[model samples]
Target: MVVESGGNARAGRPRAASAAQILEVAAQIADDDGLEAVSFRAIADRLGTSPMSVHRTTGGIDALRRELVAALVGDAIKAIDWPTGWREMCRTFAYALRDLLMRHPLVLEAHRQSALEAPGADDIAHRVVRALRDAGLCAEEAAYAYATLHDFVTGHVSIRLGRGDFESTTAPAERRGASVFVDHHDYDRRFETGISLLMSGIGATLAPRIRS
Candidate 1:
């Protein structure tokens, strides 16, 4: 999806770089050093241009960040071609999105902040909803199912990322302490089981409604 920005050029000179170029540089910076590391000058320096030129093309830093998030999410959505079968489709999408968001932690933050209110997000939502409808769900039922499934995936990934306290350290003493105090959960297995239950629940509910 093309990024929505203010203008294509600066005051007098024609801007040499595209929004995509600027956004990619910004996304790279954010992905490497966290989102706070990204700034207009940072992107400009990487692009070998002035900060004003970046601003002219991107509108401002906020818009630039928004576009960066959109590009990342859009790429994630495009990575998984629509799989066949309802169960396969839903599970594949959930896992794919989880993997992508996990790769770019800042994108998760941006998604939480803006909900991806762009064409990229819309496309992703539409594909999942369409899968539900294809599996005998009516419009309203599909909407609800999509909401439940999407929320589950988003929440799971968010929790996994936000659970930094429980991640990365496997020391014996710490493991013992965590086992005693934190009661660690196998999130991957938990997510798969939950996905099965969710899809089954939707099928049970939607099948009856479709029959009646």
Candidate 2:
């Protein structure tokens, strides 16, 4: 059945396509080719349907891209159990986001676009902001912290992936009498140190202000 995004059912509804099916095909196209390769026509071709069918199901490429982001974010969210300490929650969440991006590298571009429009993306942002607010940050401070943390995590992943040096650059093996350090271990240690420094600074800055 032809399922248009508007949900308009004419006298002959045809078979309405499922949004999930459309998104899955679009994601496959994006992964196999790239985000630019994802179009209604491209997805339809991959799914053995006409472009109109995909457009009816997903609205357009923009809408389809946003759905892809939602799907990816949903997967990431499922990896974590929330309602814990805000700091720990956020740290784990950031790691989860990193893992998600790495798994679906092409989806990163869609994620960037979706972050500006998708309600699910905004929900994630709001969660981060709320966590900061709960940690004694004022509204403005919480907003700033959320933005900073988001940028930091996404930017770090971008660099790692862009450079194609996620392993060697992040943790190069020592030559000669090289110290006993592995890439993954180094990455974890440095990542934890950076998080600690940021949280420590935030705590110090807010302590006096909150007391005052």
Candidate 3:
């Protein structure tokens, strides 16, 4: 079933309600019972308001989900302490994004593609690209590097958390001997190793150009 939008609900302004409060309650519902459980009625029930009020504030579920994703990405970006070197900065960002996804996997559910266009997304992208440019990568190369790094980190986290079609827990049960390949325990180390290898490869490829 699609998300409940509360279009037919009775109209009434909720007393002293705010968009932030609505989002907070909606996120809480999602975190507790998955994204499908979040609806205008659910949020209103939690906030002691009406479904129409919630819907009016959020403009329906899709917009609310987009806002939720944007808020989360913005906050996560603000919390990062960027390091000196480009590689280190990229590594830190990868870790930070991974951690944020792990903590609030439902935010991605709120809006899977929204994070790319989310408020703080451009800021983080600029920082990464600037770092790469400073490290001697041309604009195109820096953009590619940032995009690749972002996809790797986000994709890894999605699979790790079983957020996408790839359910880590159920994958082994679906096929014979798949459990051997589905090593859930070692993802932490694997993620680190993956980042290290990626950084190494980028540095090696750029060393010749940087030296010139």
Candidate 4:
């Protein structure tokens, strides 16, 4: 997505370097290629400027990668019309996050490389935990539920993108042992099933404590 750059540029000069513009180009490169393909030179080439210009505007590649993660997360979170009911809220959050990761699978790779915290991650976590609390989970349970849900969505998307441990090694015969097993093609159905099971498990295992 082309993020509109802010500020004006003088005639005959490249537009003033905006982080959003750099990230927009960078994201496209990462999506077309992979996260490793994103480089100062690549972004510069797209922006009609030198790599040094891109570096100066974004601090460095590491910083830029971190910013990219935060931007992607923040943008996706903002777009979600989060539901009020706890179960629906968790479902909505899961689907929204999964969709974002599918679109930009590189976000997970960038997140891994950065290792430093992304800015908006905490806010996203808080929203998830709040939903759990509304579901009658205690503070600790809410936190655990939030983490579990987040991991499930990200892990599901990662596997769908062929980043799973058995993606390359599972023998075809082994894969055929069970219907829907090792099958990445029908991810929507698989994901829905997984989420439904998780929601049910959470309600059955934890919601009762609150109701009791």
- The best candidate by TM-score is 4
Which lDDT values do the candidates have, in the order given?
Answer: 0.76, 0.68, 0.77, 0.77
Residue 67 displacement (Å), model 3: 2.2
Q: For each candidate, give its TM-score against the true structure.
A: 0.73, 0.70, 0.77, 0.78
Q: How would you encode candidate 2's per-residue C-alpha lDDT over 92-191 as one tens digit per residue?
A: 6677777777777775776565444444567777887888788788899888887777777777767766766544545444541264434243555655
Error of 2 at 187 (Å): 4.1
List, residue by residue over 1-212, the lDDT tens digit for candidate 3.
12334353336654545887887777777777777788887887766678887788888887887677677778888888889989999998899988887777786565474445567678888999999999989999999999899889878987876644345554456662456556544677879988999899889978998789
Of 1 and 3, the candidate ranking higher by lDDT: 3
Q: Which stretches of candidate 2 lie over 4 Å from their true place?
A: 1-18, 111-114, 166-189, 207-212
Which regions of candidate 3 fall more than 4 Å away from where they truly are?
A: 1-16, 33-36, 163-184
Judging by lDDT, tell me the better candidate of 2 and 4.
4
Clashes by residue pair, model 1: none
- At residue 151, give the lDDT of candidate 1: 85
Angstrom error at residue 140, model 2:
1.8
Candidate 1: where is the Cα deviation over 4 Å?
1-21, 45-49, 165-184, 207-212
